[model samples]
Target: MPPVKIVTDSTADLPEELYQRFGISRVPLKVLIESQIYRDGIDITPDEFYTQLRQGKLASTSQPAPGEFASMFEELTKDGSSALCLTLSSQFSGTCQSARLAANMIKEKARVDVIDTRSATWGVGLMAIAACRALSQGKNHDEVKELVDSLILKMRISFLVDSLDYLERGGRIGKAQAFLGSLLSVKPLLSVKDGIVCPTQKVRGKNKGLERLVEIVEQEVGEAPIICAILAGADPEARDILHQKAKERLNCQEIWLGDVGPVIGSHVGPGACGIIYYSL
Candidate 1:
């Protein structure tokens, strides 16, 4: 079997070193702070982006241009490699569409398969990793995509936002709802099902919100193997709490605690925390 390459967008939120280790090629999204724009993860670190966010500096994100995607596809496929490109949820961004367009442009030269992960951060990151695992097992491109589809079916993600302000600003929520929810000290808990974000429930206060998140994970997942908990902003205490709860409730074989980066942090806002995992 020929070697297969794993390609993904920066929104996967996997660490930098893992990309090289796993032979993962990434296309960066743009983060706009006022008039200036920076590349996600590559041009700016997650820490820096979160600092700006916490300081009340509003930042917005943009997907890569067609040319950028074309360039990346050209470089990676220049050696006649077969590629699998995993992308952010189409519901959230147009990155997946851009990737597909680039792949179409290069189809004559190389075999490139693009998939919409219907997730962000490790929600999609785990799917990319699973593809690498399939390729390592000597699966062909078509077979690998089929196997990935199965794994993705069991994947789940849920989030707890500290405030609805950022979501409202991002147009994910209505301003009227945000105001009413804030006044009531309501923390909205959302879930990703079939690639769409749906409000599962709402609770009062951060503690109750976190507990509710863990409970939902426990009930639905019931001892998933790979679990990831991510925290936005610079709150060490919140990260630690999430890490501990994940270990206890999920009994995850490997639990990763990640810092939510600029691309996602900007929309989720400070004190946003969440988990994404799959059952073994």
Candidate 2:
């Protein structure tokens, strides 16, 4: 059997190079700024999107329509290859539902498996990358699916937003809603728990928040070999610091550094950074 094609939506936020290197297919989400609609990572970049946000532009995001997924699925599976599509959390976006609808629409043409990764940013990217590696190693479709399902359980995403304003504005705040209007200097450390964002702790300063994020990862998987990804939204300095700290602190076998895309950046806002990882 041919290797299964890996598909994911733009919210996965994998670095630009990995999509080409891994032969991954990505369907972009829409980011609306002012009167224009820009395809995430296609028409606009993270830097551009964050620059607009810093200028006080309001933005919103939308998932791709089902027809878009159907078109991609038809083209990719035209030559008899199957596809495995990994999407961000259904609790966060309807992208998974759109993909599933597309899958049913094209059921007569090919086999496509749409999985709600129950993750965001690099959490989804890591799973897609793992699936690609597994397929490269001669693992078949069923084997790859099994590996990805196991990864969903092991994956963890922890982040610190520079401010809660953007999350509150976008209505994706979840339990972090309580952090609003408390203090300007308080930073909330958040984690994606069971597909929804949940507040983990509150630190008084950015430096302390970064320290606690690394500590949380260290405590969870001490000395265990893991694959990690550090994400940033127009805040390379913070991302770099987190990367250095992870190198100094964790037993990471592989680490990927990427920018959060417009869709997630729209909700998390500028100056957001985080770590996503799972034990090997």
Best by TM-score: 2
Model 1 accuracy (lDDT, Cα): 0.79
TM-score per prediction, in order, is: 0.93, 0.98
Global lDDT of each candidate: 0.79, 0.93
Pairs that collide in candidate 1 are none
lDDT of 2 by residue, 99-176 (tens): 999999999889999999999999999999999999999999999999999999999999999898888888889887
How much is 124 displaced in model 2, in angstroms?
0.7
RMSD of model 1 against the true structure? 2.2
lDDT of 1 by residue, 1-280 (tens): 5677888999988888877777788999999998879999888888888777777788888998777887888888788778888888888888999999998988899888888887778888888877888788788889888977786787788888777777677755522252434545788887777676667778888788788888888888676566454554566676677778877767787676777778878877877888787887
